[model samples]
Target chain A: MAKKRIVTTTLNGNQTEFLCEPRQTLLEVLRDNMDLTGTKEGCSNGNCGACTVILNGRPVDSCLVLAVEAEGATVRTIEGVATAAGLDPIQKAFLEGAALQCGICTPGFIMQSEWFLSQNPKPTEDEIRFNLAGNLCRCTGYDKIVRAVQDAATTWQDHYMKNCHEKGCH
Target chain B: MRDFEYEAPTTLAAAIELVAKHNGSARCLAGGTDLIDQVRVGRLTPDVLIDVKKIAELNVLEHGATGLRLGAAVPCYQVYGHCGIVSDYAALADSCRIIGGVQIQSRASVGGNLCNSGPAADSTPSLIVLGAVAVIAGPKGRREVAVEDFCTGPGKNVLQPSELLVELKFPARAANSGSHYRRFIPRNEMDIAVVGVGASVVLNDAKDKFVSARIALGAVAPTPLFAKAVGDALAGQPINDETIAKAATAARAIAVPIDDMRGTKEFRLHITGVLTERVLKAAVARARGEHVDCRIGH
Candidate 1:
């Protein structure tokens, strides 16, 4: 058998390393090897954004990426969305808006939304719908989810501008 | 997906050697969006997965005196995000944005799309109309294939097992020329194109007549087609609804669509005409300096 290689990456703002086979995807490494189960796996393929992660500032379906490809790259999962202080503004908005139901898709939604809102800051409803189309939510019917992202766009800009000052929340 | 030995060679010579060593058992990994999916579904099972992104030649995206040289591994987001491509290669920009959502676009490369050779691929038709050339590298050296003639059938192309696509080369934009790509899908996003059309038009100085034109159709044949008949019909034609309609009819005649879950043969045939007309009008408007969103053809 071929030896497993260690992939070194700045994961969730910290330097992390793990040994993984080339066959294992970044999704499997994060969940099975690292035990960061916060990033759920809905569909193992790229169709569901359940394994969404920000790789070098762009959101990607981690399941589509090989674990070995994460070498020397930066990645952010749902675990990186919040600090020790409290829930992120987007998470608060999700809570207030009841944006989730079964919750399997929430992590992916949060990761995707955080990256998107950070990019747009204030996106139109159409833009939000268009951007978040990749992250599928079987529950909530998407009304509250869309509303939550809209609210985050409006509400997070103040907190974002005050703290990060255009460096971006993520 | 089955286990496969991985190799990431940083140089073109080294990558070619590895591929040649593995022969038909090796597959080059560009964006891996399509390749990975196909592997998971057992469509392809390679003994060696060669990561070609580390190769400097395959990652180059530059517009210089010669033309636009797009690395085979250049992702869709970068193609759509490029100012040069957005303004000059509008068809490519339009096609890139429609590949998948931002995540897929973030990782999916147009070269990978062409190499996948799917008839439903959204980027192939645009590449065809843009007069892009596929640069392939093998153990024997390199060769160039016109993008229009790249594909042989669904999920098949001209490249041999050891050959890797280095990049796509597009000629300098023609004067007074504009291009656009659009597709019809069941939904707005995250769906394969049911019918797609890409059109580029070079208008006369007054912008009232067609100096020349190129049209390509997707999901309507065994491979994406360069609509030679349509382009020939539009050359020297007056820019009008009738001319566009005539081009549309010609496009439909050249299309050999098949029935599928995405659309019926009749439905695809009708859409071929409808999209051809719409895309040509959009291209004409762009040639006249109109701000047509690459996404407007939806």
Candidate 2:
């Protein structure tokens, strides 16, 4: 084992610190060191986005990122999607739409979707499909996954609009 | 994966010194989309990983009167998303847009793609057609290499062990000039290109004749090849189907394709001509101030 270095990052809105080897990937650090296993590892390479996580507001394959690279970065993983109140709307949409068969790729799909929606709240169906191209699902054939993202986008838009109205924000 | 020492130097000089110290046992880390994968597969066992993302000079993306100065570490997404790059350098933008799925683009850098030296790298042909120049920094100071000559062979480049690519510089887009890139793939998204063609043309004042042209092909050879014959055939020629067909034939003649799993040599050769014609036509249209989607053939 090489020397384990301390990495400080903001994970899921919480300032966190953990010890990891330099060779360990961000996915490994999130799962093993931080106990945030929601970010699954599928290909372990960049081909599959099952290990997708939002780093500094951009969705990237955590498997391709070194653990030390996440130092001083803001990381949002699958475990960060749902709040203390309840499941995030995207997660809820995935469940309601039955978007997963094995569920191995769900967390990645949800994370990418969240980042996509954050950038474009009212994305078209084509945009949704293109945005989710990195993620792979052996089951469900992606129709349900696409539908789930659409559902989530619509629901989230309505929720955001309502909150803005309450806050007197146009 | 082998454990390696990691150093993120904020200055290019420091990074160069680190690599010099490690000799050939250190690898510069940019986005790590490619390097980390190689490390995980045991293909690379660098004694030290010099993370260059923290180096400010290597992460710049500037568009000025001279042209575009793309930092070596600028992510593919940033390159594609930059309005100036997308508008002025359409061929490069098309290549960046299709480099990988969105997540890969978020971290993959064009410089990394070039340095990776994959024969089928999507960005190489476009960069070559755009006449991009790579700025390399090393213990010996800095040097510039034309993008077309950067890759020596598959998975090989001319970079010294102690050197790092600092940035890529593209010439200013000339008036009445347009560029286009197209690739044949088994799938629409997230697949290696079977045959890639990038074409750029500068039309005469009337926009009916080609004043100058450049054609570059990828995936059909050990390294991305500039189709000089094709460009020479189109120079000062009337921009018509006849000239386009002749240029395509020249492209096919020069293609040295291999029988790869993605495509047969014959298939790649055939598509090289086909894509060359299509890309040239699109480039001509773009040069005529028309908006053309280069990915239409995908």
For TM-score, the strongest prediction is 1
Roughly what TM-score does model 2 have, to 2 decimal places?
Answer: 0.96
Query: Can you list the residue pairs that collide in candidate 2?
Result: none
Q: Show model 2 residue runs off by greater than 4 Å.
A: A159-170, B294-298
TM-score of chain B of each: 0.98, 0.98
- Residue A157's lDDT in candidate 1: 84
Model 1 spans > 4 angstroms off: A161-170, B294-298
lDDT score, candidate 1, position B166: 94
Fraction of native Cα contacts kept in each candidate? 0.61, 0.80
State the displacement of the C-alpha of residue A144, model 2, in Å, after optimal TM-score superposition: 0.7
